[model samples]
Target: MLQCGVAIAAMLTVAPSMALASADSAMLPRNLSPWGMFTHADVVVQTVMIGLALASLATWTVWLAKTVELRQATAQARERMAALEGGASLAELARDCGEASDAVARLVQAAAHEASLPGASWDSDFKERIALRLERVEAAMARRVGQGTGILATVGAVAPFVGLFGTVWGIMNAFIGISQAHTTNLAVVAPGIAEALLATALGLVAAIPAVVIYNHLARVITGYRALLGDASAQLLLLLSRSKGRPAVAFGRAG
Candidate 1:
């Protein structure tokens, strides 16, 4: 009789723990990894993640394309500046530089055209007119080279908010779920909370690099514009030096 009573007591002690273990196990998330959380996340949360990912992809693409573009363009502009410093006449530089579409070439072309105008030698505002043309060309070149960087700025400024929206929506959904299930168990609530935070994590993932890349590209573009400015100054010097040789800056070259 006493042995039977001990067995009954042992079962009573172990039974609730066993049942509770089973309940806890049931509440635990099957997958808590990032990819797992994403897959199991609410549809709205998933959409936010996907958008942030695309933003990140755009950021990286801009980085790669702009890096290559700036490298080649800066090198070319520097070479042209070196030529400008050599005091090559605008007419000579025009033919030697080739391709009037590049920034430096266009500067030379603009000066050449302005200097070759009728009565150019007698025009008291000759250098001033050429300087105006060079300035316009420089502004246009800066705008062109900076074309794609705007997207980076946009992403950096907006992505974190996008992620926060996902998190808020997710946490809201989690609370709704907890209310419906009529429980405040941590096990029941953690998965949803974790999944929601993942969106923010992805947001940071998309934003930080975008901000960094934008700043870097800005610096590169500033350097390029400075090079353009130097070239313009050199062209003006060439014009001043050619005062004794009037045809050098004022007449059309065949």
Candidate 2:
């Protein structure tokens, strides 16, 4: 009888430990990974996360394409300006530079075309017209070069809010779980809170780089526009020198 009583006591002790161990195993996550969190996240949160990721990709793509285009354009403008540094006639420069979309080349061609027209004059009025045309070209080139940058601004402005929405949704879902489970245990709450904060972290990850990239590209584009203005000034100086001279043939073969 005494041995049977001792066995009952041991069984009671072992039973509680086994029950606690089972509870702990159930509380712990099977895989505490980002991909796992994503898979287990609410549908709305998942959608927001996906959208923010795509926006990040768009920011990088625009940065790459615009960087290449702006660098090439800035270099070409400098080269054209250097070619004009010598006493080369505007007609000679235009022919050698060809009829590409080069800012300096186009400016020269426009001036030459105006000069070739019947009744064309090189007076204060004529010079004003040329200056106006140059300004229009500058504006157009600026617009063209700045295309696709607006998306960066949009991403920078919206990504954080999108992430915040996801976080709010996640926390709300966590509270719902708490209410359903009828418990305030740390194990029950920590997972949901961590997941909610993860949304905010992802948001910062997406937004900070987008804002930085947009500002950097803005500065680079501004510099490129300044180069275009310098090219316009150089062309105007060439025209000023040739104002009273005989008409020069442009695009003539050497």
Q: Write the per-residue lDDT of candidate 2 for residues 1-254, one digit (tens) a residue.
A: 99999999999999986775566457545655877777777898888788888888888898899899988988988888897777677777767766678676777677666666666667667778778878888888899899999998998988899889989999998888778666676776777766776787788788898899999999999998898888888888888887877665444221
Give me the runs in candidate 1 sitting further than 4 Å from their true place: 1-28, 248-254
Structure candidate 2, residue pairs in collision: none
lDDT of 2 at 140: 84
State the local distance difference test value for candidate 2. Answer: 0.79
Alpha-carbon TM-score of each model against the true structure: 0.88, 0.87
Global CA lDDT computed for model 1: 0.87
Q: What TM-score does prediction 2 earn?
A: 0.87
